[model samples]
Target: MSALSESRNPGATRSLQVVATAGHVDHGKSALILRLTGMDPDRLAEEKRRGLTIDLGFAWTALPSGQEIGFVDVPGHERFVRNMLAGVGPVRLVLFVVAADEGWKPQSEEHLQIVDVLGAHGAVVALTKRDLVDEPAIQARTLEVRGRLEDTRLAGSAIVACSASTGEGMEQLIGALDHMVGNAPRPDSTGRPRLFVDRVFTIKGAGTVVTGTLTGGPIAVGQEAEVLPPGHRARIRGLQTHKRSLEVAQPVSRVAVNLTGLPTSELERGDVLGLPGQWRGTSVFEAWVRPVRGLDHPLTHRGAYKLYAGSAERDARIRFHGASELRTGERAFARITVSRPVVLDLGDSFVLREAGRQQTVAGGEVLDTDPPARPGPDPAARLRARIGLDRATLACRTVIDRGAIRTPEIAVLAGVTPEEVAAHGAVRLEGWLVAPDVLQGAAGELSAALRAYHSKHPLRPGFEVSEARVLLGQHHRVLSDPGLAEAVLGSLAASGAIVREGAVVRLPEHRASTTGREDADRLVAAVEGGEPTPPTVRELVAAGFGPELIRAVCADGRLVRISQEIVIGPTMLARAEHLVRAHGAPPGLTVSGFREALGTSRKYALPILEFFDASGLTRRQGDVRLLRAR
Candidate 1:
């Protein structure tokens, strides 16, 4: 099947977004949403009777501009903060509800802090239950809420008054929500999809279905995906966004996927749905964090806490730099060594709460999701952080200078999106980062070596391509990247750096010469004048010829070494070559014919013919020899 048809949905290709509610308990978050959306968020009858949200609830509303916005109504009770955080990461704009009657409560302050640390772009503050208070009281509460929001991302926000019972300012709240949706930035959908599965169940005929906000990328029907942490691969048999079947669901949309190949009993709410092998469990990462204000005890180094990011939660230990006790309201560079790996990206906001009490302690943005250096106060760690802040060009240069870097390593060091890294030519994605020039340089060196080899041994064929690769120490795959390596070799060949001879390579313009040229000439003259059987190396050396001269002539194929004592020049091979050419088989010329032709004795004739047979130039057939075909 085609990749798209097998993996993507044909109908669900639209952008769906998430908006969440933030406020103190009993601040009228659910009621205000009920007034604006006309859908009751608090589904449980007990919750409705108690006049408080005890669990997370989902609601949908259409803005005045006709844009659909989903709301995650989280419990504001301090005890249920975990549930509140579980729904926060996927929200785009926050509906920060503050009661005009109550002003700012503890839960109100904490919820605002959560939104601020989450780096929410925009917010519409719903001043709920305005009818319960007079005008002066409303003004006083607005000022108080404003004061509490100072020095936060949500400091400058639109506050609209509304009453769930009478609907005093529902229209203004809807308009503000519409404005927020219009101005909110869209989430990136280029990376692997990470769906934080908050709910899972089996619907009789639907098999197993899991639902959550799609935080990262698009997911379609028939896609082969995985549930992370446990790493189970499953086919997306179906997908639904806001209860409607879709071909592709975009980022920030609430999606329910019917998955095949996994039993409903094996999946859990905390597990993430992602592309297979796209994310791994990580135990350590560096973060920039600020402590909560007015804490009785300082944040100790190696202090354990509950870490929440995206859909994954883990118990992590915080290791602070230079201070054992982290003071309240203090910002510092800290490392959170998690107990397990969760899908996270650079700049992803995370909240850290005290492990046992589950109280919010600190929160920060993810600077490096897959840091290489160990988390500590060391020079290498500092260097890594500095590199993490560099621009793409500079970062690419740094990695190239270092020789090789993996994709995850580059993502962490550059603090850039992995998609950006993949898109940029800054690094070659051949399982590692290598300087494009280095690969080119190695190829050039190999070609140069080949040309030099050919020039020195002009009569012999060039060296094999395999030998050149060994000298270059580059893999065959590296040589296959288009003109990456080949272009370099071509340049070297053009510049007389190397010579290409069939499958062999050699050096250009190289020749083998001897210091004792005269002595070598005399030996050649005497050998040619006498029988074709050449003299031994000892005899040639004794006859006023040095060993170096003999070795050089032998290396150039001018003299062929049959044994330690036996040697023959190109003249003897020429006769053998001629014999093979004349009679397709050398055995046609018997031992007596070979001896008579070379004017050599029986003793020399047998050894010469036998040497030719052993060297594959000729083959022996019983008592005679046959020439081998070229």
Candidate 2:
């Protein structure tokens, strides 16, 4: 037998298929499994004593073609329907059992509806108790089962009559199952592993153990994992499949994970186990739903509904789009909000059951995990655009929907890896993924803001950096966050949309101009005439000279800025520097002596000396100033 081995590691198995069993109570599903695998699937003592399958049992067998198949034996009693849904939710194939004498029963129809909703990949019907019926009765039961399955995902399934008690036709049933397993398509491995825990128990020295069908990818022993809802970290101490210890467990197979750092009381059934930061729980999502074929009334928002997905079930409320209720056989997009958060992704299938009546109501396919808080009119248009898209495209679309998003946020919202999101063609600004249209719109708004800034303060060099950030935040809400706003500015600067200086931002073509302007000439003349102690900024603003014009003349070198409130002509600044150099060498120039040399008062001299000190032209020690060495 050829073991399904990973190419990277020659001795390691890469693939294992799991098939779940479904049928009516006491229909010989468990007995048939024992006959085929020679191992009893019923484990609980109460179940064995009652002679009815309860909870979930698991077994495995190797096929003739070296393919290993694991079986999840689900209870068929009406009372244990929740257990059955949990077993079959993540699985894609089934071995449907039906008693030949009873034909189709109540639980059989309900289970079949679930299988159809889940879109089972392939199936084989085991018509059990064949020894109790004649050849004619066997033919009639086969026809009835086939007719019922004609409209389901298991329509083309092969039905083989068998009796687990008498071991009649067991060989033929095994061959039929082997053929079905050999041709089944492989499960998707998206590099994000999620195991919806179905059972949590603790062994003496091993600590907590959780069992479920692992999907999405492979999980290795000793890997770091996380349990959701409580959202705590746990390490995988060991892994097993069908009682055989494995270094790594592949997707779409039954797995028992021994986890450390979490108690059994904290981790329960319906919780999720996954790699840290790879999964996010959401309480509300949007999906496309269809009611069952024979619903007695219209499916409305006012019902006690429970949603089943993967292995988790939560109380849910449904609100249809463009309508208040959904009629039978009709499909519509709807928003489903659950009482508790669940980890779901796009294209995931879920079953909705009316809890009061204990009957299945509708089934749905998830379209969006993180939907808008208020869906505007005709929201279905947005969902329709998302149909049939791959993960990368969907991640890119998420960026478009939100205007700009970080890579980590894209991974969480779109259910893809960071690497996958990075590989897309969208514009990447720093750590944020930006859609092309959004980037273009931001560029246009920034350009317009810069133009307006230049027009309002014509003499200034540029708009202030702090003010530019405010404008960007106002235009794009996504950039309101700390680092994201800077990323947008950087991208704009790099693309020549604007130029960013130390304290200001401006259009590339903008420059501070004092040429042929009456107001600029007047401001420069006023600062030049004020000599050593010029009119302060407050005085200039009070004297009908705009502060922007005062700063502009200073920025253009027509006037020198000695302090926030003090400005002087370039000639005055040069004179002050020379007077300080001549004030001479060592124990430094005292403030009083320099004030006398510059022919200025103490207030003007102090600010000039401090400005020189700040500009690296001089160093101050106590009240003395020393000229810096050239």
Candidate 3:
């Protein structure tokens, strides 16, 4: 079996490596890959006819050291720069090609700028067509290329002079690639796999298939995945890497997935496939951007710009921090608003191109994908503090900023796992991770609302829970979510900061106080003297006993308010229950029968029975009452 096929076995140990090519048009990028792998990098019919690369092409080969690596050959024409970025934007290791006779050209400079912005993990620069140049000419061209690499991330990358036609220096070029691939760092796997689809096509019998670089984690066959932007779900029917069938595709390698659920009509290039809920899409985000070196004009908010990241390209509008415009070399914080929602994460690099001018202008690292609606004063400073923070610290700060957030939501909002979020030591209540100060503030606000409620309705036992929800909703936006709102109130109760009773909530110190007031005693006396048939609330109000005092007496257990109009003494309530038990048998007790037993009219007896029914003390059957078993 071939080396690429061997890696697909379960016991294979060597991880696959990927390399993307960068250079000017017809500078032997495709030619070098064809010479190295014995497979043509230019796959399109027009590309072979015109002797030019029009789009991205793929080829793979085993290195001299038995390491399997793949090459993404990209077009070097300025018009196809979008396709070139799609190839190189996600891969970290680069194989830069420059013709020895022609030296550095315009597209050469532009491609280098893109590689520098994306920040390669390792690179090998190939100076092709060495047979066309003299030894002195080759040395001079080497020095010219070295000048451009002085401060770039690819500064120390080896530059090999070779000829794809004659195979000059081919062995040295192979050795450099082997060394670069050997030392490159492994891709971090967080169990959240993301595949940015660069090419989408339907197979005759395999259905829809998409090819892209897999990162963040491994994707196994039969696992469910979601296609983002529209978020249609599908199952992975099969997996392939370098045209070899595999049960699972590893990260930092090229992968093609055959999906079962969604059709090719629904998916397109730039769409993402991942585990459901692993990625969140946002149109607005904050970033730290710096212009590319040697721009002829200053970078301003005005211009038709396109933002490129992974395989996705979006129309974007940018606003700078603390300034109206930025010079060629100045760096500043910026807020980018895309034309539509796209999946972005922290520290992901993107390139900005001025479409009107048809040139790449700037590149930036994403600082925050979910920025605040109104960026307050010195928002730049706030973002700067977060620039170098670890994931845990950033998750804690995000929780603090949101005051109270759903625990699982951190994974969706910031890509921080639940365990990482828990390690920060934030307070979690009812699945909500809350900031310490915000929790304290929420308790205080609830207490204040209860106090106001008690003062306004001193006769009431406590604040009604329904009203409390509405009142708290006005104070804290978190209260608008029913689950989160109940969580806050429950946490306060758990901490003994408040008390909850059935449908009401109250401060711990609250009480229905009519103590030592003359109206309280008078109301009780009037209710007791009236016996089974007590005076109506209208009569009590007419006698100068306010409705508030009557309600206070009722709340104090001195009186039972049977209805809006009827108020009875506690003695009367007990007497009615006794009569119901005595007469409640066989046919059950009727309102008139209880009325005569209590020596009251039907008007008072009807409401008395209803109050008993509401309290679960009795069950009503049509017009008769049945005694309930305690």
Using TM-score as the measure, the top candidate is 2
For each candidate in turn, the TM-score is: 0.67, 0.80, 0.78
Cα lDDT, model 3, residue 365: 89
Candidate 2 overall lDDT versus native = 0.85
Q: Where does candidate 1 have its weakest 10-residue lDDT segment?
A: 1-10
| Candidates arranged by TM-score, highest first | 2, 3, 1
lDDT of 3: 0.85
Count of clashes in candidate 1: 26
46 Cα displacement, candidate 2 (Å): 1.6
Worst 10 residues of 3 by lDDT: 1-10
- Overall lDDT per candidate, in order of appearance: 0.71, 0.85, 0.85
Tell me the tens digit of each residue's lDDT in model 1 across 99-163.
88888888987888778877888898999999999998988888887887788888878888788
The per-candidate count of clashes, in order, stands at: 26, 0, 0
lDDT by residue (tens digit), candidate 2, 453-540: 7776667778777777777778777767768778888998998998998988999998865562678888888877887667778888
Q: How well is each residue in 450-511 modelled by candidate 3, as lDDT tens digits?
A: 78767756666786777777766777666677777787778888889999989989888877
